[model samples]
Structure formats: C-alpha cells, structure tokens
Target chain A: MFENLLTWLDSPQTLQAIVVTGSLLLFGIGFYGLLAYTRIIKILISLSIMESALFVFFLGLASDPHKTAPILGDLFKNFEKMNDPVPQAAILTAIVISLATMSLGISFAIEYYKRTGKNDIAQMDALGEKR
Target chain B: MTGFITLFTLLSMSVVALFSLRQSNLTQSVVLFSGVGLGSVVLFFIFNAPDVALTEAVIGSGITAVVLLIGIRHMHKEPEIEEVMMENRRGIRRIAIALLVLLTLLLLGKTLLGALSVETSNAGQALLEHAMQAGAANAVTSVVTYFRGFDTLGEVAVLFLAATGVGLLLTVEKGEDAIYIEPNFILRIGSGFLFPLILLFGLYIIVHGHLSPGGGFQGGVVIAAAFLLLFLTRRRFGLSHKIVTILESGAGMAYVLLGLTGLWLMGLFLGNFLPHPAEKIGMLVSGGIIPIIYILIGIKVGSEISYVVEKLIKRSHDV
Candidate 1:
C-alpha cells in the first residue's frame, strides 16, 4: 500500500492534480484579494492573477506524459506523439487577449485615478444621484 | 524530474502571488507580479508549449512589467490604505468562503480527472494530422495561423481596440507638471549597441516561426521591447505617431488582404494558396501564407504595443 501510494505520488496524474489544485488555489487567492482590496490597481493585479491561474489550468489540462511539443522537430519524428496544438493555440490567443484586457483595465483605473485622486473602490462614488 | 520542476514552479508562483498581494507597496506588488509571469512562462515551457512560453515570457514578464511599472510611476508612491479587515469576516462569511473553496476544488478535481480519461479532442487530432500539409514544422503555428486564422484576425482587432482605448485614456489632458528623467550613460550606450541586434533577433523569430516555436506575436513583442529599451535610454527619442499608425494599420490591412487573397485563390479564407512542395517543410520559405500572416502579425503587434508603451511614457513627460 505504501508503494502504491508512492507510485501514485510520482505519477503524471498526481502532477496534474497538483497543478489543477494549485492553480485553483491561486484563483481563490486572487478572488480573496478582490474582496479584500480597495485599491483599483490591486484589484487589476488580482484580475491579472486570476487570468494567469486560468491559463495554468488550461495548459495543465492539455498536458500528457507521452506526448512531446507540437513541433515536427528532428527529435519528435512521429506526429502522433505530439502534444495537443489546440490548447497551445487557444492559449496564445488567450494570452494576447488578456493582455489587451489588462491594459484596458489599467488605463481605466488610471483614468479614474486622474479624475478623482481616489484609487479605492469603496471610496469611489462618481455616479452619485446628484448631477 | 519534470513533475518536481512543475511542482516547484507552481509552489513558488503561489508564494510569490501571496506575497505580491500581502505587500502594500504598489512597486513591490508590480515586481512580484513579474515573478508570477516568469513562473507562468516556466510552466508553459515545462508543459511542452514552447511557442506559448516565448509569448508569455516576452509579453507577460517583459512588456507587461514595463507597462505596469509605468502606470505605477505615473501615480504617487503611496501604498494603498485598506479599510476592510480580515477580522471582519466572522463566522458566517468565513464558513461560506471555506465551503465555496471546497466546492470549487471538488468540481475542478472531477472535471480534470474526467478530461484526463478522454482522448485529445478530434479537432486537435485533425490539426496534428494535417499539419504536414500546411508545410509547417510547428504544429502550433499551423493551428494558429492556418487552422484558426479567423480567431487570429479577431485577436488583432482586439489589440487594435486596446491601443485605441489606451490612447484615449492617456490623452485625456496634458500631463500637468510632468517631469522626465534622462537615462544613465551605461544604459544609453548599452541600448544603442544592442538595439540593432535585438531587432535582428526579433525578425529572425518572426520569419523562422513556421519552422520553430515562435511566430508573429512573440517576435513583434521582442521588437517592441527593443524600442522600449530605446525609449528608456534616450529622452529625446520619440515614436512618431504618424509612422507608427501607418505601420500598424498597414500590417493589419496586409493581413486582411492576404486572407482575402487566399479566399480568392482557394475556396476558404486563409487557405494554403501558395504552392507547397513536399520538400519545403522545414525551410524558411515554406508554410505558404502562414509565414506571411505571421510577419504581418509580428509587425502589427510590435507597432501597436510599442505605440501603447510610447503613449504611456510620453504622458509622464508631458508639460
């Protein structure tokens, strides 16, 4: 039973479990920060962390022990042994899109900072009932 | 060994993330954020996605750090003051958060385990099988440029929108009493010497993308990094908005036209319209319109990102 547990600990499935759980934990950390932090920049930073966690999870989901990089390099002769290109491709798009979103968010945050010297969400009441 | 490395990287990533949040200093938080980006790049590399690794390394750590730092510098150095206390989360809220976390972990574990039991998706398998026909050695490149070209087009549009939005935000009013600092002598001299070489390397990555693990976006970001280096070192150096817009929009137009050309020649948009000799698989000139689109992507991304960086930097120097 100890040997079985050790083998399981060393297995790729165990690695996958670690990655998934760790990434989800990272996401949870970001969510907690989102709830706790009032600074707009901190909130944006938390958002970026959440995005990174999601990326990690997607990459982890696509990982396989038997497969290699999806490149037809000399070392990887067989196409069948290649890793899934879809997730990598999708991730490339996601990374770029997320960068865009983050930059836009940062810009909005800075703009808000500029208009009112407050970066705290709790303190911001820009759209009040008064005109 | 790979498992151990993955575990270590993720562990460090989590630690850094926790520290980044715990710190009240905005600059330190931004620096730790770069650590998170570095960890992700390592994670991508370990996961056998070299192309994504390169992109993440270049954009995530390189450009993203600089952009975030610029934003931080634009504002005062005051650490954020938090009114909410952890002590405020009494019995009910703490229990709710704990339950939510447990449910999330359970759901994630079940879903990932189920996914692991299945084979790769059919579309992914199909792309891998037909990758050779695209005359590309990198299956990711083929998937990105040819198989899902429309998605790439949309990504470019999104980037365009981001640039526009950043421009609008940064240009709201003239930066009042903004001051610019001149870079040190060593940085100026080093950047001057390394500028051309970095530019050359970026181009090599863009052109060799079809044959290797890089493509347009990664290469373009490298080029933008080079420009950013120049911007940092030289106070007088300024990106001409006219030229940048022309190059950026021109690359976008070229990408669309190339896709339209493929559609005109072949039945589908972004099809392999150029002749693909079997022997040209790993050559620089191989991959038909894939390399072409990649070059365009590299140029467009490079121009737009650099323009964004320039706008952010110039806003700091505005009188």
Candidate 2:
C-alpha cells in the first residue's frame, strides 16, 4: 500500500496535485496564523502568503518539461523551443499589483498603531467608530 | 526540463510548507512564506518568465518580508497561554465565499483548464516569424509595445490608477515632514554609490529592453528602487516637489504627444516612427518608436512610484 501510494505521488499526473495540495496547506497555515497570531503584521504576512500560494498554483500548471524559457538565444531560436510567455506577462502585472497592495496594507498598519497604540486585532475592536 | 523541475519543486515546497506550518511562530511563518516565494520564483523560471521571476524575488521576498515584520512589531503576538480569541469571526462570510467560489470553479474549471491547453502557438509563432518587422527582437516586448499598443496604453493607465489608489488610501489631510530617519553611516555611504549605479542600470535596461527581457515596467521598478534608497537614506533628500511634478506632467504629456503625432507620421496611433526594413533584427535604432515609448513609460512609472512612497511617508509625520 505504501509503495503504491509513493508511486502514485511520484507520477506526472500528481505533479499538479502536489502543487495544489501544497498551496492549500499554505493557505491553511496562513489562515491559522491569522487566527492564532495577534500580531497585526503576522496577520498581514499570512495574507501575503495566501496570495503567493495562489500565484504558485496558477504558474506551476503552465510549466512543461518539454519547453524551454521563452527567451531565445542562439541555441533555441526555433518555435519548438519555448514555453508560454502569456502567463509570465500576466504574473508580472500581478506581482506589481500585489506590491502596491502590501505597501498600502503596511501604511494602514502603521497608522492604526499610531492612533490606538495597539496592533493586536482583538485589542483594536473599538466599534465601527474612530475615537 | 520545465515539467520535471516544476513537479519536483512542487513536491519539495509541500514538504517545506508542512514543516513551516508546524512551527507556529510568526518568524517561522515568514521563513515558510519565503520558501513559498522561492518555489514560485522557480515556477516562474520554469514557465519561462524572467520578468516575473525578477519581480517575485523583490516583492515576494524583500518587500513583503519587510512589511510583515513592520506589522508584527506593532501587533501583539499571541502568547502560548492566551486563549485564542477569534474576534468577530467571519465564518458565515467565509462559508458564503467558499460556496460561491466552489460553484464557480466547478462550472468554469474545465473551461479555464482548457484555456491553458489552448496554445497561442500560432500567435506567438506569427510574432516570432515577423519579429524583425515588428521592430523589437524581444517578442514579448514587441507584443506589449507594438502588436498591442492600445493595451499597453491602458496598462500605463492602470499603474497610474494603482498609484492614485495608494495615494487616496494612505495620504494624510496635510503634508508633514518626512519621517526624520537620520541615515545610518552604511546606508549613507551605500546610497551614494548605489543610487547612481541603480539609475545608470535602469536607463540601460529601458534603452536596451527591445533586444533584452527588461522593459518599461521592470526598468521602472529599478528606477523606483533608486529613489526608494534615497528616500531611506536622506531625511531631507529634499526632492524639489516642483521638479518632480514637472517631470510627471511632462511624461504624461509626452505619451499623449507621441500618440497624436503618430497620426501624422505613421497614419496610425503610436506607430514606430522609424520604419524597420523587413527582416532586420537587433539594431539599436531598429525598434524605432517602441524603445522611445518604453523609455518614456519607464520614467513615468518610476516618478509616480517615488512620489507615492514619499507622499505616504511624508503624510504620516506631524508637521
């Protein structure tokens, strides 16, 4: 049974499964940290981790063993040489978008700390109104 | 090669992720996240995306970690003894989202999966076949600048929008002195050397992006990093607001002028000004208006990011 399971996990079909499983596990842990950690930064970090996992799931599937990088040097000038570049372009935009978001998130964390002198979310629950 | 690496990496990331999840400390979590980032970077390389890999290295590891650590400094970390108080838990919201997402994924998963398999080999091949005629040796840059010039226009607009949103959300009602961080000796000396080097390289990247993998957005980030270094090392880096504002306005104006000018010059909007002779690739002057547009966009994006960061830090302090 163990041998069969190991073989199954090692199969090409299981590659994406492994990635998906890893991503979900990362999400779960981040969520757990978000729940378990009171540090405001930790929570945000967890959120970032969750976001990275999703990016992984998307890009991991696009990679094929047969294809080379989209970059063409002297050796791989032909059409048969490269993998997809669309996802690469898409992810570049996504990475930039995420940076803007994380920075904004940090700025808010700083302001919240200044105002309340507290960073723990539980300590931060002062109704919907700002004092 | 890519497929094998991708699979092996996916497996390795899972093992590392599991180890991290077990650690239960905020710092360990960050390390785990870094592992995840490293894996994603590998996936990017496997998928043949140098640009994305560069971004993931910077944003995913460096910036995200810094931001997270900053957040952690302010927020309380749950001690081992404290009752885990899940405040105003969004269990219902989570369930609703999960259900909605599941339903959507179930319906669209096949189609979405199918879309990935549906190769754009024809389109990519077409671009590759006539890459010389398109005026850029880098096919990705060619598609971005020439084949889809209008889309490139909107992408620049989106960067503007993101900068604007960061501005709106993070700014204070009135300006104040920037955080009076006296530059440390190492950073002070380092910035002196590093800032000029960064600017020089950024220009090189944007100028040569037609033949290389770098382009406006990537080079823009490089330029922004130089400004960021200044913003860090000098409390009174003393950017002349007037100059920055002028630079911003000029870049925006130039993009517009180029577009309108193209109507007369090439009879199409944003057309490459110098006509590339068919099948002539890799000439510095071959890509014509494309390299020019990308350089302009790089300047625009760099200035905007610098302004946004400066404004955010400046507004946070008391006048």
Candidate 3:
C-alpha cells in the first residue's frame, strides 16, 4: 500500500490532478465571494482571483514532468522535451489584459463612490430603480 | 521530488485564496491576495515557464496589490454591509448556493479527469520547431513577439484603453491639493538609493528578453514598480504628463511603423523582415526585429503603468 502511494505521488498525472483540483477550488472560492460580497471592490478582487485560477489551470495542464523550460542553451539544447510555449505566451497576454481590466474596474468603483458616496453594490440604484 | 513540492505549493495557494476572500479588512485581503500571487510564481517556475513566473511575480504580486491598496485608500471607509447581508440571507438560499457550487465543481472535475486521458495536440511541438526561425533562444519570447505578435499588439491596445479610462475617470479637479504623508528618513533615503538599481535591473531584463526568461511585460512592470517606490517616498513629486504621454505614444507609433515595415518587406505583418540566421539563436543581437519590438513594448508598458500608478497615488492635478 505504501509503495502504491509512492508510485502515485511520483507520477506527472498526480501533479496535474492536484493543480486542477486546487485551481478549481480557488475558482469556486472566488465565485462564492462574488455572490456573497456586497462591496464593489471585493467583487472585483474575487473576479481577479477567478482569472488567476484559470491562468494557473492553463499553464499547469500544459506542462510535463520530463521537460525543461523552452529556452535553448549550452546545458539544454533544442526543444525536444520543453514545456509548451504557446500556453505561456497566451497566459502572459491574459495576465496583462486582466491587470488592465482590474484596474479599470477599480477606477470605475472609485468614481462611483466619489460621485454617489456609496461603495456597496446593493446601494447602486442610479437608473430609476427604487433602493 | 518536484511534484511533491508543486503539490504543496498548490495546496498552500488555495488556502491563501480562501483566506484572502474571507478577510474583513480590504487592505489585509489585498496583502493575502499578493500571497496567492507568490504561490503562482513558484508553480510557474516549477512548471518550466519562467517568463510567466516573472510576469506574475512583478505584475500580479507587486503592481496589482499596490493598485488595489491605493484603490482602497482612495475610498472612505464604509460600514460592513456584507455582514448585514450575511445575517439577512435565508438559510435555504445559502444552502442552495453551497450545494450548487459543489455540484458544479464535481462536474468540472469529472470532465477534467476524462479530458486528461486524451492526447494533447502537437501544435506546440510544431511551433517549437519553428521557434528557431525567429532567432530567439527563448521559445516563449519568439512565440509572443513573432509568432503571435498581432495578438500582443491588441493586448497593448487594451492596456492603453484601460489607462485612458482610468485617466478620464480619476482626473483631479483644479485647485484640489493632493493629500501627502511625509515619509520617514529611512524610507526616503532607501528608496532613493534603490531606484536607480531597480531601473537598471528592469532594463537588463528587457534587453536580455530573447535570451532569458523575462521580456517586455515583466520588465516593464518592474520599471513601474521602481516608480511606485519613488512615489511612496516623495511628497510633491509628479511625473510630467507631457513627457510620459510623448514616451508612451511615440513607442506605440514606433511599434506600428515597425510592423508596417515588416508588411512592406515581407508579405506578412510583423514578420521577421531582417536576416536572423539560425547560428545567431542564443546571441543578444539576434532575433531580427523581435528584440527591437520587445524594447518598444517595454518602453510603452513601463511609461503607461507608471502613469497609472501616479494618477492613482497622487490623484494628479493635470488632466
């Protein structure tokens, strides 16, 4: 039984499984926060968390146990067993874009507060809705 | 083994994320969120994606956390409406949400397990084989700056839009003075000492992008971070709007002109128009137009983010 456990732990699939489970749980936590939080800032934070979870999931799944980084050098020549570069590039773009969006959302929230003096989403009834 | 370490990091990251969301203080929550970013950097490194790791470390943990904290600082403290909502929520509704989330996660897990059995596509391998054609040692850099260069331009445009929106929304009115807190001697002296070194390091990262694990985005954020530090120390210091605007717009226009040059020389936009011999793969002056494009991106991103940071912290007077 101990040897079986050891073998399972050694496998690349085991690491990938752990990564997926962790990131999904992280996403669920963010989802719960989005539903539960009333503050616009908290909701934005949760949304950013969700985005990070997806980034982690993509990069984690694209990786392999045997491969090194996808950079050629004297010690490690060629891309024979390198981790996928596509996902890394994609995730790099996503990270920057997400930062931009998060900051934009936060600026909107700040403006909303400055103009209306209300920070809670429950209180934002600017468009003819009775609060 | 590496797998075990990665597993531990993943577990710790999830725990941090949960705790960050559960924190009552917004500042504390932002700090905890940065902790989550730190974990991700570790995971990225372990997974052999050092470029992503560096980007996450600089942008995710450093800049994003600072931006969130400044955002909280900009707003006045309010009563805990969330607590009231928690108390007023019906037990049945709460239970329903809890169960639904669990069920959805279970379904996702099952799908993921099934999908794991299928073979990953060979697209990445094909790209890897062509990565040398771009004359970059780092495959990720070549893929980002050469293979999918147009997508990166779009991403930069999105960042520009965000910066513009932030500037439009957060413009401080005339005659309104910024609230400045005096920094202590240690912070003032230390930040002054570290600023030049940090800027130099960011330049190094940008210049060596094609041969190393970092590129424009990561280095750009690092440069912005140095400015953030300077902002923290000084009271009345302000980045000249004209200079920053010129730097950002000029870099952007230069990027497009370079792309047009490629389109004119080669049939494809943003193509490697210059000669990039395979023998020059690991050299600094290699990668044809890629290094030059990255430098432009670095300058643009650095200037833009620093401008955003300045606007956020100072609520600057100049519109």
If you superpose only chain B onto the true chain B, what TM-score does each candidate give? 0.89, 0.76, 0.92
Candidate 2: DockQ?
0.31
Point out the worst 10-residue segment of candidate 2 chain A by lDDT. Answer: A9-18
Write one digit per residue (lDDT tens) for candidate 2, span B1-319: 3345656776676566546545556677767767877877777765566767777876677555654654454344354334334545556437644654564455345433543243333335555565556666666677677766677677777767766665565555544535446877887898899998999987888888777778777777778778777877776664566776687678878887888788788898887777776445566776777888888878877777776666555654222
Clashing pairs in 3: none
Q: Which structure is stronger by DockQ: 1 or 2? A: 1
CAPRI quality band, candidate 1:
medium
- True-vs-predicted CA distance for residue A115, candidate 1, Å: 1.9
**Residue B83, model 1: Cα distance from true site in angstroms:** 6.7
Which CAPRI tier for candidate 2? acceptable
Clashing pairs in 1: none
For model 1 the local lDDT of residue B304 reads 88
Ten contiguous residues minimizing lDDT sum, candidate 3 chain B: B80-89
Fraction of the true interface contacts (Cα pairs closer than 8 Å across chains) found in each model: 0.49, 0.32, 0.56
Q: Please give each candidate's TM-score.
A: 0.91, 0.76, 0.94
**Model 1, B244: alpha-carbon shift in Å?**
1.1
Runs with alpha carbons beyond 4 Å of true place in candidate 3: A1-4, B80-82, B86-97, B104-116, B174-179
Put down candidate 3 lDDT per residue, A37-127, tens digits, no spaces.
Answer: 7787788888988888898888878888678899999997677778789999999989988888888888888877777777887777877
Using lDDT as the measure, the top candidate is: 3
lDDT at position A64, candidate 3: 80
- DockQ of all candidates, in order? 0.53, 0.31, 0.60
Q: What ranking emerges by lDDT with the best candidate at the front?
A: 3, 1, 2
